[model samples]
Target: MSALWTIFRRDLTLLLFGAPGRGGALLPLLFFLAVAMLYPFAVGPDAKLLARTGAGVIWVAALLAAILPLDRLVEPDLEAGFFDQWALRGIAEEGVLSLRILAHWLSFGVPLMLAAPLAAGLLNLDGAQLWTVELGLLLGTPGLAAIGVTIAALTAGLRAGAALGGLLAIPLAVPLLIFGAGSLQPGGEGGLLLLAASSLAALAIAPFAAGGAIRAGRE
Candidate 1:
């Protein structure tokens, strides 16, 4: 219990504030904002068009922001022999990764949810649409975090793993993107339900898959 708590705290700190060679929540937050800010300039000042497309834009920005932290998630720890140390101490990799998924969501997902309102405004979303966007993100970001950690573990020791992680994650996250953005539509409650199901499925599988990847990498 103590060791898991310690590791959780460590992962959360590294993810939120960053380490020497790793990115933190700030970079993703800034990148998300940048995309939201730039969209208006690119498409010109059409409020209806912005409002119509804004929720989807927010979904896309959140997805991209989720990717920014992939390089730092598991690779840095693997390179530092942190996983080996945990294994030597009799801590299960699955346990550690389960905690890591929580930490990753806290660092990556929550901030994106918090920032969604600002993105909503930039994209000219209405009050109702903003509410829906928030709800969709709440359900969807967990899956994004799970997928990010899983891919990070899978591609940890590979060449250009960061880029590969992005490629892998984008395809896997497509369901979340589709459902998340689709939920913003007026009769889209079904999309939200599907989004929740996808998130739960990812969360259920991520810990075991990521643990196996880490163990394989050590062999």
Candidate 2:
């Protein structure tokens, strides 16, 4: 229990503070804001259009933001011999990866949720839309985080793994995007339920998938 707590704290620190060649929590948040800030200019600042389409845009931006840290997630620890050390100490890959998932969600998902309101304002979303958007994100970002880590694990040792990770994560994330953005529409609360289902599915599978990848990489 103590060891797990320690690893979780360590993983959280690495995810938040970041090591060399890895992005910390701030980069994704900034990237998310940048996309939101730029969309208005790209679409000519039409308020009604922005309000109508903005939730979807936020969903896209959030998806992209979630991708930003993929490269940093697993490779750094793999390269630094941390995973090896954990193995030597009898720690299971699943345990480490599970902790990592929690840390990643904290660093990635929570902050994005925190910044959603600002994003809502930038896109001129109304109160109801903002509430739905936040709710959608609350349910969906965990799936995004899970998918990101799973893809990161799968592509960790590859050349241009970050790019590959993004490619891999995007398609898998379509369900979340669909449901998350869908939730902002009129009579779209059902999307939130579907989004939660997707999140639970991802969270359930990620640890095992990522653990397998890490274990396979050991050979």
Candidate 3:
């Protein structure tokens, strides 16, 4: 228990503040905000269009932001032999991965939610729309975190793991994107339910799958 807490603390700090070569939480936050800021310009000053499509833009930005940290998620630790060290100390890879997922969410997911208001303003979303976007992100970003970690683990040993991880994550994340953005529509409250279900399913499956990937990498 103590070791896990320590591990969690270490992970949260590294992910939040970043390491020497890693960009950490700030990269995703800035990227998300940048997308929001630039989107209005790209499409011109069409207020109606911005309001109508803003939520979906936010969802897309969040998805891209989630991808930014994938290379750092597992590869750094795996390359440093941290997984083997934890295993030698009787820690299960699944357990480490589970905590890592939580830590990863805290690092990027929570910040994105907090920053959503600012993003909403930039994209011209209304109060109600902003609320829905927040809720959708709350339910959806965990799934993104799980997917990111899983993909990171799977591709950690590959030559172009970072690029491949991004490709893999985008397709897998389509359901979340659909349901998340769909929730912004008038009759789309049900999308929130599906979003939560997808997030939970990913949360449930990611640890074991990522753990197995780690073990496979060792062999």
- Which candidate tops lDDT? 3
What RMSD does each model have against the real structure?
0.9, 1.0, 0.7
Give candidate 1 misplaced runs (Cα > 4 Å): none
Q: lDDT by residue for model 2 over 118-193, one digit each (tens)?
A: 9999999998898898888888998998998899999998999988899999999999999999888888889999
Once fitted onto the true fold, the runs of candidate 3 whose alpha carbons sit more than 4 angstroms away are none
Higher TM-score: candidate 2 or 3?
A: 3
Candidate 1 versus truth, CA RMSD in Å, comes to: 0.9
Candidate 2, superposed: residue stretches over 4 Å from native = none
Please report, as a residue range, the 10-residue window in candidate 2 with the lowest summed lDDT.
14-23
Clashes of each: 0, 0, 0
Put down candidate 1 lDDT per residue, 1-219, tens digits, no spaces: 599999999999988898778867899999999999999999997999999998999999999999988988899899989999999999999999988889999997899889988998899998899989999999999999999999999999999999999999999999999999999887988999999999999999999999999999877
* Colliding residue pairs in candidate 3: none
Worst 10 residues of 3 by lDDT: 18-27
Model 1: colliding residue pairs: none
Each model's lDDT comes to 0.93, 0.92, 0.96
Q: TM-score-based ranking, best first? A: 3, 1, 2
Write down the TM-score for model 1.
Answer: 0.98
